[model samples]
Target: MAEVLFYHLTESRLEEALPDLLEKCLARGWRVVVQTSDPERRDALDHHLWTYRDDSFLPHGTDADSSGALQPILLTAEGAQDANDPQVRFLVDGAEPAGDLSRYVRAIYMFDGHDPERLAGARRRWTIDKAAGHDLAYWQQSEDRRWVRKG
Candidate 1:
């Protein structure tokens, strides 16, 4: 079964949290696709990733970029995805799960816990995914800013 993980963001914002998660995926030799809610968010994230840290860099490109298939990590908004045939997918900004989950080794949903709509959406997805029989895990950040599995 495909594995699905839910990330509840209460202590940190997306811009502060995403790059670190993407780095972990890269370290595992897994190609990644980060799907945001809209083109603006995707573009914004594209810029953020480039300048997130002075000492570090994430090798990523958007779907519109040349040689998108060659990028280890790809950024795309809703309706565009998997340009590099990634093994892992990250859904942020209220983006929903893919129809065919089996294609991915793992799928993650990261939502802002402080947003009522996002929290409700996460609950909805949790119910749907659980009913669909995909292996699901929940993660929430601890007081020390470390992710701890909640379920």
Candidate 2:
């Protein structure tokens, strides 16, 4: 069974919170795939990952990149994201979870907490993933802006 995490983005932007999470996944030697709803979102994230910080670098490539198979992190759209054989998958910007949960060690669904639609979507996903028997955790911003897992 895959470990599924739902990250409620309230205090931080997706661009701000995502790179650090991706860095942690890389530190664990896990190949990652960041799946977006569309190619435009994928390209935008691809650009942000490269320049998110001046002092840091996250080595990643896109599905469109020739070296997708060799990348530590692969940013892709809804179609055929298995090119990198990712161990971890991050679903962002309203992207739905990839159907084959067993293929991934961990799957993260990140959504904007301030958006009513996103919040409802997360709730719907929670119910589905729970029914599917995934070990689930929901993380939301605390008073101090740290992640606090809630029931």
Candidate 3:
């Protein structure tokens, strides 16, 4: 079973925290897929990954890109079954977990704590994933703006 990590975003928004997390994934030599339910969110994240850091760039391509398999990071909306065979998947902005999650080494659910709907979704996912026997972890942002394991 794949490890499921739920990130409760309280201090930083998705755009703010995602780049650092992506960089960490890259450091581990893992390909990544960042999925959102909305196509616009995927496009916005595509742009953000480019401009998020001035000194470095994250190699990412959207599903519309022809050479998706060659990209280190693939961003797409929901219902994308083949997403570059990434080792990690990031579900942002209330995106549901992809159906074939066992293909991934880890699945991360990044949800905004301030949004009621997102919070409910995350909780539901936590309960579901927990019962499904996947290794589960919960993290919340600390005052110093770092992810701290809460459970």
Candidate 4:
């Protein structure tokens, strides 16, 4: 099952969340593909978190070319399609929750309570009425979060 986890964090929280998120996915034996909008920040993350044997990294806007290393696949919006690698999991940072999210079997969307325009755009683009799948999730720190498997 494909899984996508999206996170919306304050710039201050990114350093904390990134490592924990990466470790969590690694512990679960999931191949990770991360998409970011910033090249420098992505490169920094690649330098710190990427290991030759366990992870891989690519900067946003870089080519889709990949090393055989198990490192997480890193990319930008233009390279997002490269995520076609099978059994892959996605971690999108500072990304709006729109687009063809149905490409993954399981996904998580994090909200930051700002960017009403982007949020509304995502709501319009990705809605339960149009998506197809068994498990769909909406998690807010304030709500009861659970997976909803389609019938």
Predictions in order: lDDT:
0.90, 0.90, 0.89, 0.44
Worst 10 residues of 2 by lDDT: 94-103
Q: Positional deviation of 46 in candidate 4, in angstroms?
A: 3.0
- Clash totals, every prediction: 0, 0, 0, 4
RMSD in angstroms, all models? 1.1, 1.1, 1.0, 6.5
Model 2 CA deviation exceeding 4 Å by range: none
Query: Which RMSD does model 3 reach against the true structure?
Result: 1.0
Better of 3 and 4 by TM-score: 3
| Candidate 3 overall lDDT versus native | 0.89
Steric clash count of candidate 4: 4
Query: Candidate 3, residues 43-141: lDDT per residue as tens digits?
Result: 999988889878988999999788888889999886554558889999999998758567789999999999999999999999888888889999999
Worst 10 residues of 3 by lDDT: 76-85
Give the runs in model 3 whose Cα sits over 4 Å from its true position. Answer: none
lDDT of 2: 0.90
Per-residue lDDT tens digits of candidate 1, residues 28-134?
Answer: 99999998888889899999999999999999999878778999998888544777989999999998755767688998999999999999999998898888788
